[model samples]
Target: MLVVIGRIGRAHGIRGELAVDLRTDEPERRFAPGSSVVCAGRSLTVKAARPHSGKLLVTFDQVADRTAAEHLRGQVIEADVDPAELPEDDDAFYDHQLIGLRVARRDGAHVGEVTGVLHLPAHDTLAIDAEGREILVPFVAALVPEVDIERRVLVVADVPGLLDPDAAETVTPPEGR
Candidate 1:
């Protein structure tokens, strides 16, 4: 399986260094020297990398000079990972691990099945397919308290209107004269 680690930004200098917009939490491990990544259907080896501003300036052995780096701009960098590999953090889960999992309420009521995982600027969200309808739920500890991979179930908090919009209480305005 392949996971996105970063996106190639603009060329940093006259050299082959390119700024990278991080997508992964562990940048150090993913962008370390001698590490390998795939971009634009080509494998690239990390020659050097360093933190610049808020992004990482990385030089790839396959790219030479600013022209080569410019050609890689806007390309996404992906790394191959084992399917059975789990994140080091217990609370963290890969998108593949969550997809296809059965989503249910705390009371064991079935809500939906996870279709996809969206990585937004704020946080990760779960895209659920509920009876042919799409429902997006934030993947947070408060909302998603438990994720049982062995059982293939994701327990969601019973927040009003979260699972069912019609279940939420409606406010009625006072009668006018």
Candidate 2:
């Protein structure tokens, strides 16, 4: 099956290179030269790839000029990836894998169910639906200690006032209050 790895941005220069907003962990490997990715339902092979600022500069074989590249703006780049090719790191997991995990505290307090995974510049955050409330739980080792995929459960750490604000100790009261 095809998995979206990146989205093509505006044309970078006159050489048909476009900026890529990455969704994958290894852009260098996924967007390497000669890599064929489906863009806008068409196969666009990577002619070249280079680092540009914080984004990736990618040239497509089908794009020969800036005007041609412009037409592909906002196109999602998808790859026919095998599940075995996914990251093997114990801590690393795909978004699809994390969704639907049952999130609970170490004390067995059911927090919520993971609805989605958001990847920010800093880290991935788990979007949880907890009793009609949307709770954003950071996907970190300190906060989330266990992830049993087979069991479909995520063991959250016991941090004071982390999962519940009322549980946090009042270090200092408000100055006015």
Candidate 3:
């Protein structure tokens, strides 16, 4: 299956090279030269990919010059990857596997469904859509105790004020009329 590995940022220079914010842990291995990547729902061949500063400088076969590279800014880059090739450390879970899972409390109370995964600057968070309201819960072991991908169930630990929106609000006394 194809997984998002990076995003094409603004054009770096006038040589068709674009700045890429890599989302994967192994950027150098994934964005190697001659690698096939899918961007903007279209397959593109990577003509050259090299590290620059903290991000990657990439050039695609079809993209030429600054104008062409600028058009691809903010576009997500994906590539076909095997799930088994990923790291299997404890407390680590694949975002794709978490999608469509049923989220519930430790007491077996249904909370919501895992609609999507958000890759925040700090860490990954599970996007749960419960009764039309979106709830972002961190995928830490302290918050999420159990995750059964085969059964599509996730057991979340004690997370106060997560379900009630009003719990997050502060009440103020009304001014005397």
Per-prediction TM-score, please?
0.76, 0.69, 0.75
Instruction: Please list the Cα RMSD from the true structure of every candidate, rounded to 1 decimal place.
Output: 4.2, 4.1, 3.9
Which consecutive 10 residues in model 1 have the weakest lDDT in total? 117-126
Clashing pairs in 3: none
Better of 1 and 2 by TM-score: 1
Per-residue CA lDDT of model 3 for 27-86, tens digit only, reads: 766788888889988888888888889888998888979998888988888888887655
lDDT of 3 at 125: 82
Q: After superposition, how far is residue 92 of candidate 1 from its true place, in Å?
A: 1.8
What lDDT does the true structure give each of the candidates? 0.89, 0.83, 0.81
Order of the predicted models by TM-score, top scorer first: 1, 3, 2
